[model samples]
Target: MGSVGVAELRRSLDGLLTYLEPHWDFVNCHMVNYLTDDHWQHFVPEPLRLELNTAKDLNQAIDTLFWRSNRQSQQFPAFASFLAAGDHLRLENYEKLLTTVEQLEQQLATSTHTQLSIKEFMSAKKCHEVELTAALIDKLVQSKSTPNSTSFIVDAGDGKGYLSSRLALQYGHRVLGIDANTTNTENALSRNRKLQRAWNGLTERAELQSQGIIPARRGKKSNQQDASIIPPSLENYKTTSRFITTELNLSDLLTEHFDQQSNNICLTGLHTCGNLASTCLQVFHAQDNCRILCNVGCCYHLLREHFSQQEFFGNKALMDQQVDCGFPLSCYLQERKVRLGRNARMLAAQSIERTLAAKELPNITLYYRALLELLVCRHAPHLKNELQVGKVKKFDSFPEYVKKCADKLNVPWLATVEEEELLLLLEKHEIDRQYLELFYLLRMSFAPVLESVILLDRLLYLKELGYEHSYLIDLFDAVISPRHYAIVAIKQ
Candidate 1:
């Protein structure tokens, strides 16, 4: 209800942990082998399942309880009450524990308005992120007691240099974009070259739009001519390929690239993946010169948990080289030995709002995959959940899906199974399709709550370090960019 302070964050963390303790299995269960794993019997209570099955429109019911209805206002069904009373899984209670995006935004007065145009180069979502982030960085730079014109921004995990280009070109700030991939660095430079050429036209279009005047569409020739009109040199925007870590010194890197020395620095990343976000925070704390941090992290599935026994998703050699884990950055979670398993972390990445808005459901391939698991048990027991049958081409029927999967998995025994048997298997489990869909929706509903825990942990980490100005700003529209909250801090 109030701005999420340390005390409030701690309380919310405790409440969320308590609420989620009982449902870890449901969160962690692999949907690929739902039936084979006996997930329904193990996790879902009979009464709730029965109620869901009996609903006239299960899709509508899922939408109502999961997305459309708020805990306090909505008239809940009998199943909802059953979940709350018997299982201690109350949507209303969970909602109360979460620090809402609105609450986070209210803590800082940010302008949603952007000076840049949504040109054909960037999506509306990306345009929004870059403009907003650049504005915040500008404000942060201005707020510094000893604001230096020589101050530069360090864009970590700066893929394709969207934010970096904007900061350098539009805001007149020196930006150094660092990414792990050399290809990305090259591509970012190429993209920036194009952006620099069309910068004037883009700004003019944005200005016209602000004044309620839509710019006229230009022909291919006109567009080419506009692109040929190169703006002044953007030597300020430099990029490099380096996998960033906490130990990586920003001051030294700045000197290496720009051939200039400046202690005043703002470290930023737009949707920095997994450990890179954590690295940005660590780098910020490690370097005295790094005064500001604005990071939006994504790919929670890739986060290396300190307490988790699960195998790290990325290069294990690289992970082992890391000094710290991605999760439990705060002393509170670390002391408690908190662990959100890889499966749960993957679930946390889901977007319930976007799913509901699109009226989307899990692909039929999900059901097919689950069914494939059944065949794997019968034919190749050793290969059950072991086969890495990734994405398959679209198929018209279950038998076709099986053949394609078998070929991909190199499971000759599975491929040999008769088509009639596959059809019969499909017919027998016809009702299970609905069950799995419902189960998927129910599991996805917990996404935001799980995400809140992760985000709060990062915020709490900053708080633990005695940074008074640290904030978790909900900077973008949830539907457009699910990983919207920016972990911002201005070191005093």
Candidate 2:
């Protein structure tokens, strides 16, 4: 699959879009609309309906759609088949990429990259993301076509400099971590300083232990803990706080940190958010010095679709440019003027495997929200705006929930609605709750398919530009880092 180039990705992207176009409403629609909207059933074929009805358990039916092959004709054939198309989007055939630290101390490759687990520094998932990304960035740097090209990393949306810090401190790369938020930049710098001191102290302690001077503590093995952090020589790990707009220049930004003569940059962003991922690609594409790109994107809901039915989020003037605002980057979809709405993008961000493995049921919050909508309709019809009951926890009863919502919305009339009435409303809509959960699972099954559309669009964009070395490497473990696909492109 490493040899599989633009032609294959273009073909894959086209096919995925073809299936998704007509079924867009099915894959993208909200779970809250389950009972209200009669249209979801229209998307499910007759065969699927028959199978869903005959299932031993509704959740088991979901497992059949999500975990196993959807091609089975035994039951839920149509729905299962629909899900199978999504499974194809998993990048099962792509090349697995690994990087080796080539410096003298790292001469002998003793092992596959050791997992970094630093407490107080980050979550286990975050630790996995940073380590894996640094190694891949190492590969991208060494793999550069120009052997003499001095590699510097421009970390786009480098929130708290986790990846930037690792690359700069451990890998000895000159990293310029950029972020939209000023506070993040300041915090990252502060955090980097503390981490450096910790590493400095650990290095001394480990050296003493190795010299057979400092005795090892019993029941407290620190060698395993020490391996993750290297002796920190924080080499100019800098941050520039700014929003990554489409017009941002890499060459100009690099000149600010390095000498004006500096060139040969590798643009990398860990979990580049919303339109920023697309922004990173555009920056990589536009800048001559940006010879390599490794981007793992997240926050799909924040992406502004070029062809979306919803309002585009961000500066309207930015949208006026030729860029697609991260949607339908492929020429095939561009020709058809394809658009994925915000809701659709949000739905795409969900993880079916993680959700099912962890047994994450639909939050009762949905049930509360739906019932509140009904209450709004019956009692406060004049209230034009929707009431947002944010994160109500440990309520004794449904009436208490209503009172709190009423108080928040400043709707005194809700007090008049009795607890008996609220219970009756729950009684009336009890079946809707079950239906919502079932449909939520159905919607979740399309998660990977929708994400594939977004990722493949980016991959095809590189191919469209005539770069052949580009590949989508499933970089991190999905259970650890949900946004695991890294778009690696090298210009020949």
Candidate 3:
């Protein structure tokens, strides 16, 4: 889809609000205000509050932050982290702001009184789990009754192969685990092999019982034994059956396998980053054997939004082709239009843990957010050489980190006007931080709905292609694996 200019996009935003207002109202009536109780207190109800607070002034915030006609002249960052306007915001001011924010983050990270909130994270996981499982079971049932086809379980972007191994051992289905990360691919294969060996022993023992060599226990039934249960110690499969391949290229491996056997294949992925999941979807569409597809994808921007099939993967139907994103990308763009705002409250809590661990001041969070905003504007991905977060080597001080970033971004020093300008920008932006935070929180609250849209799209796609026995089911703990939706499309 062509990029809609800010003015036209604002109109589209209004249309979306008009559509979502009723849904917002429904939430307000049924589920909005449960923050008082400890069980529900994890959700701050900030978004609902924003909906109420901005009911009269929503357009004002939009106009101030995102709706200016001049905004169309400047390019926004393709990645979420780099969505700020670097040139418009002076480099010195940006650097100081980032520096200050980093110091604040360091302080936060090294605080003594910090305690992480598991409830908030757990709630988000719980919400996603419900939606994911529903979609998987729905697809599996629809695809079950068809004849003369094997059920091929294909896990794309299979990190460490936890889910893939479980599916293979417990479900008795042949699985193909694909990943771009070689280490992760190797780990997954290793885990699957371990699980496979453990499964083989169970199979052998079951065979022995079937021959009456071993008596069936009183409490345990034959069906229970028949059900594949992986032993904790995977010593048995070390010398026996192997469940998956080790670190093979997905396109080459799948092309060869599918060419030989085309009737039975189901594609799945969990948290496939950027273009990888998109590639999986394209592969599924192109391969005639890929009868069922269940993918829970994250990292939206990595998806080549405007690319045609030929431009990206040399396939035509996988191109955009007037497909409704199903995702509220326009609405998300509207959300971004608000201001230099982010929902790092969860990160804030995590920062608390880091602070306590590091014994540094808690204010490092401010620096991190500030730098993140600057990075968003700068549109630079992979901060390995410059700014680092989440378990990195020690920096002597906040200034040292700033110097590293400044050196990398090619700026010498901060000017007085830049400092003043950056602080002023922060003050101006902070006025609407409450609203932005609310919007972010609200967006997160709707993650289940968002995932549901993706799941439903795949389900409908399969149904449209005449797969009548598709099913979807809850595969595992959503907290442990947020991408817990399992799609089972079978042809018997």
Highest lDDT model number = 1
Ranking the candidates on TM-score from highest down gives 1, 2, 3
lDDT of 1 by residue, 160-221 (tens): 99899888887778989999889999999999898887777777778899889988775454
Give stretches of model 1 more than 4 Å off.
1-4, 53-60, 66-78, 81-114, 145-149, 220-230, 312-323
Which is the winner by lDDT between candidate 1 and candidate 3?
Answer: 1
Candidate 1 TM-score to native: 0.89
Q: Which pairs of residues have clashing backbones in candidate 2? A: none
Relative to the unseen true structure, what is the C-alpha lDDT of residue 350 in candidate 2, on a scale of 0 to 100? 83
The true-versus-predicted C-alpha distance at residue 486 of model 3, in Å, is: 6.4
Candidate 2 residue-wise lDDT, 1-492, digit = tens: 346566777677677777677778777665544544543475555665666543255656655654453467455666767666666665553333212123311432233333333434778788788877888787677666356566788899888888988787666788889987799999999989987867645445545665667635434556656566556677668899877765777777877877654467899999987778887888788878888898989988877776775464445554454244677776766887878787778888888768866767688877776677667777876652345456777677778888877777687888779899999988887756655666777677667778888888887787788777677777778776778888877766
Per-residue CA lDDT of model 3 for 1-492, tens digit only, reads: 112133432443344344334344322221111211211224323332332344235444333223331233222212111112221222122231112222322322432221111111124454344234323423342344247654556777667665455444434445666654567766656655654544545455546665668634434455545456645443211111112222223344544544434365666776665445545555555666666666665554333432112222233343333233322223344244321111111111122112223333224434334443453343443331233333323455434444444555554442112444445555554534444433333333333433333333334344344454433334545444545544334332
Candidate 3 least-lDDT 10 residues: 340-349
Residue range with the least summed lDDT across 10 consecutive positions in model 1: 83-92
